[model samples]
Every structure is written in structure tokens, then in C-alpha cells.
Target: MKKTIVLVTLFIMPIVVYLFFASGITNFGKLAMLTHDVSEIDFADSNVALADKITVLGFLGSDVSNKKGNAFNLNQKIYKRFGQFKDFQFVMVMPKGTEQSVDDLKAQLGQLSDVSKWNFVFGEEDQIKGLFNSLGTNLSLDANLGTPYVFIIDKERILRGRDDDEDEGVKYGFDTSSVADLNNKMEDDIKIILAEYRMALKKNTAQREK
Candidate 1:
């Protein structure tokens, strides 16, 4: 009888673990479904219009304790380099539970004079998760969870590059190196997108002259 009881316990443990992790993945997929295009979202400040061309949006998960992570540095560098592109906009979305407030974030960004050329958006945890989901990226839902993610969206609303951290259609299995390579490739991809936008802008301008 004891042997039977032990066998039953062993059989049930793996099932329980699988279900727990599976549920978390499902929840993330649901959250991702809530994301809408940036053009669809109304920016509180009208001076910064919705990008009509290619846009690069980076997600930085900042904590009050450590404000200088690689994510922050990457954003600062990108802003300093390309913040002035008329057809390209760089947006940084902060994770939830960060010590910084929207105003505080703005103030911190103010230290970088070039930062004024771009827009800084304060994102709610759920909304940001939805954006990740829309890009097909999965982020931890916990209050303090953060991930470094970059997304490139074209004017036609097409999402280019791998969005989710997980392998497509597979649950829980992640390729860390693949994600890192994708992030690195984003800088080059952004340049290509910007060039396309510039060409389109030139075409539009020439047509208007005619």
C-alpha cells in the first residue's frame, strides 16, 4: 500500500509543475493581446505627434536602487545619436514599480539636453505588458520584473524582428543568445527603416513640387 501511495505522489508532481508554468504563459499571451499601435494611443502632449514613419521603441525596466543598467545606457546612447531624425522617434517605456514618477523621469532626462528632442513615455505595467505582447515578447508580470527589449514598427503597422523572448509557439523555452543577437541587430535595422522613411519623405516632397 505504501508503495502505491509513493508512486501516485511521484506521478502527480510533474503534472502540477507543468500546469503552473503553463498557466503563467497563458496569462502572458492574454496580456500581449491588449497592445495597440502607438499611432492609436493619444500622447498627452500634442507637440509630440504620433510617428507617421518608422519608430524605435525600447523598453527599459528601471529600479529605484539601480538606475544605471545596460538598458538605461542603451537608451541614452540611442537618444544622443538619433533623437533629431524627423521621421524616426525613439521612445523609452519604463517598467512599473520604479521609484521614478513621470515628472521625475522627465527631470532625469532633462539632464541630457538632447533628450528634449525625443518623447519619454511613462507606461503602466499592464499596458506595457500588452505592448510587449503585441510585439510578441513575454515579460514577467511581477511588480518588479523587468526585461530589456527593443521593438521596431513601420508606418504600415508591421512589427519587424522577433518580438517575444520565447520561441515562437513554444512555451517556457527561451533562447538567450538569440534574444541578445536580435537586440544588437536592432541598431542596424533602425538605420534601414530610417533610410526607407527618408526616401518616402523625399518622394512625397518631390510630388508636391510637381
Candidate 2:
């Protein structure tokens, strides 16, 4: 009786494990690009460009202090993980006059992690609107010209996100205020996009070797 029970337990365990993982597979092999050729020309007073890098883009608006919590949440949850990866960057688009506000935010975030990849770019109101409009997302900037949401942009200057997100169907951005969104959905999408690029790089290298 003991041996039979042991055999049955072993037989059922693998099936249970497989089903658990199968149920959790939400993302497709690659995250679909929702917006193409997002403008990169509006960034000012900075050397950062969105052309050939994976960027987590955000807008802090004029009242930087109000968004401090959002920034901390993002830095702790997302930036700390992928910030230092090659060609990965965090770009916060701020209005031109608020450079000091950006500096203060940077100083605080610096205590938490090495924020060398955190690039703050200044832009005029019109320029900022032009850039934001190019994203084609349903999201809008707030009264101070900021939103609590941030988006993932790929190397080709395209916005990458889920087309069949269970809640929104077309998830254009992740809310920094929600840890669950960052952990469960955003992180998985990030991993998928990174893997896609890495695979392409490997294939190119193999072709070169041949």
C-alpha cells in the first residue's frame, strides 16, 4: 500500500507542475509593437537618443515632488533590474525649466541604486506634446504635463506591449503605482523583448561565423 501511494504521488507531481506553468503563460513569444517610429527629435539638453536602445519612457511633468512615489516604485521594481543591461536606458522627459527638479529626484534615486543610465531630457511644451502624441496610446498627460504611466520602447523606436492584455486588451503602458502590474505583466514583457533581441543577435553572429 505504501509503495502504491508513493508511485501515484510521483506520477501526479509532474502533471500538476506542468499545468501550473501552462496556466501562467500569458505573453506570446514576442511583445507586439503597438506604435511605430515614435519621434526622437524632441529631446533637448541631453545626449540620449531612443533610436537604437530599449527605453522605459516616463513624464514627470513640472511638479516633480508629486511624482516622487511613482519614481521610487519604478526604480525599485523595474529600473533596478534592467537599467544596466546593454543598450537599455530610462528616459524621463521633463519640461525645459525644471532641470533643478530633475536633479533633486536623481539625488534621491541615486541613494537606492547607481542611476547612471537614468537620462533626463528637457523639452519645450510643444516639443513634449509632439513626442507624446507620436506614441499613439490612449493615455494622456495630466495638468502639469505628466502621467503616472510609463511605456516600454524598443530599439527600433517602436512601442512594444501586449495586444491581448486580459484587462485592457491593448496595454500601451504600465502604471508605476501598481506593483502587481510591474511584477506580473511588465517584467514578463521586458524579458520577452530582451530575449527577442538576444536571439536576433545570436543569429547574426552565427551567420557571420559561417
Please name the candidate that would achieve the greatest lDDT relative to the true structure.
2
Candidate-wise lDDT, in order: 0.50, 0.87
TM-score of 1: 0.55
Candidate 2 residue lDDT tens string, 19-93:
433333444667888999899954576578998899999998999999999999999998897786799999999
Model 1 lDDT at residue 160: 52
Clashes of 1: 3
Please list all clashing residue pairs in model 1, or write none if there are none.
32-133, 136-164, 137-164
Task: Tell me how candidate 1 scores on lDDT.
Answer: 0.50
Spell out the clash pairs found in candidate 2: none
Tell me the spans in candidate 2 whose CA falls farther than 4 Å from its real position: 1-27
TM-score of the candidate numbered 2? 0.86
